[model samples]
Structures are given as C-alpha cells and as structure tokens.
Target: MEDTDFIVNYVKSKLITINLEILIAKDGEDGVRKGQIERPNLIIADLMLPKMDGFEVCQQINSNPKTKDTRIIIMSTRNSKENVLRCYKLGIDDYLIKPFGLDDFEQRITRLLYS
Candidate 1:
C-alpha cells in the first residue's frame, strides 16, 4: 500500500498555516469511519491501503447518506487512464498523482475549498 505520513504532514502543515482543521486517518477503514463521524469538506486518499483500498473507501463514502456529498481527491501513484476514469466515475473531485508539486497541490486545494 500507500505510506502517507509525509503527505499527511505536508498537507496538515499547509492547512494549519491557513487556519484550517485537519484530521488524519490510520488507514482506509479509519478514513471511512472518520469521514462519517467528522463529515469533513474534503478527503484526500491514496489508492493503495491496508484493510481496504481507496476505491472501496470511496465507494463506502459515496454510498453513505451522511457523506455522499463529500468532495474526494485521490492522491496516488496509480496514474493509469483506467484509474483516473474510475475515480471520476466514482465522483471524486480530483485526482493527483504521486510526487506532486506542493504549489500545484495547494492550488487544487484552494480551488476546491474556495470555488
């Protein structure tokens, strides 16, 4: 799977600098559970994960009445056309490939959060 400590820390720092609240999940299951409980505005997830993969997590979140409207961004190394298409079909707001630039990532976050 996906190891997201760095990504989480990076995003967390950026969000914190902007005075935004951030929550980090331990794994895919944790992510879904937290999403349901926290009802956050956005969720950035990795495609590969323990317990459950990101696709399942996304499906669960999308299927839930409480979190169906939540915006999702898939941040992963899986950059195949099929993967991107699948994410869009699942209604994900955006898909970011691995090793993304911080500025681009921040811009996407800003656009989603503000626009």
Candidate 2:
C-alpha cells in the first residue's frame, strides 16, 4: 500500500470511536492547500511528500497566522535524531515514527486533540 493510504487507514481506524473529518492529501502542496481551506483542527504529515516536502508544509502552516494554531503531528519513516529535533524546532505538536502501533497512534492523537 502507498504511504498516504496507510496513514489514512491508520488514522481512520484509530479515530473510528470518535466523530471527526479526515482529509487526504496526495502531497505536501495539497496538504498545505487543504490546511488553509479546511482549517482543520489537527494535521498529520509525512516527511517525504511529493511536490513539497513535509517540512515545508509544516513551515508554511506554522508561519501562517490562520493555521498556526493547528496542531501538527509528523508521521514519517525518518526517525533520525536530527529529523525529530528539527520537527520540534519547527513547532510540530508531535512526532511518530513509521511502523508505529495502533495503540500508540491513538494515544498520541488523543493527547494532541484533548490536551
């Protein structure tokens, strides 16, 4: 399965118990546009995206006053310490490595949304 597909399904499964809207973006640019248009309460992004990288997407969202408050969760295969640190510096609310378990995903999402 593709990365976006996997992420969408995973998020859906975890959020099934709650009522929320899910938007799927094919790449970073789309994600940014959707973020601006939808003004979603939260965003989950992958590091390596088409068109623009996730870092750029996050940077744009964070820089914009309209979307700056949107909680961002970075989910990616890149688990290098530097990458993780960079995400934090960029103001991401949370970071999850790829191949994470459903329980962890749910917990993180819960913490982000509720806390």
Best candidate, TM-score:
1
Q: Candidate 1: what lDDT? A: 0.87
Could you say which candidate leads in lDDT? 1
lDDT of 1 by residue, 14-82 (tens): 778777788888889999999999999999899998888889988999999999998899989899999
lDDT on C-alpha atoms for all candidate structures: 0.87, 0.85
Error of 2 at 27 (Å): 0.8
Point out the worst 10-residue segment of candidate 2 by lDDT. 1-10
**Superposed Cα RMSD, model 1:** 1.6
Tens digit of per-residue lDDT, candidate 2, span 1-115: 1147766787777767676677878788889999999999999888888888878988999999999999999988899999999999999999889889888887888888987
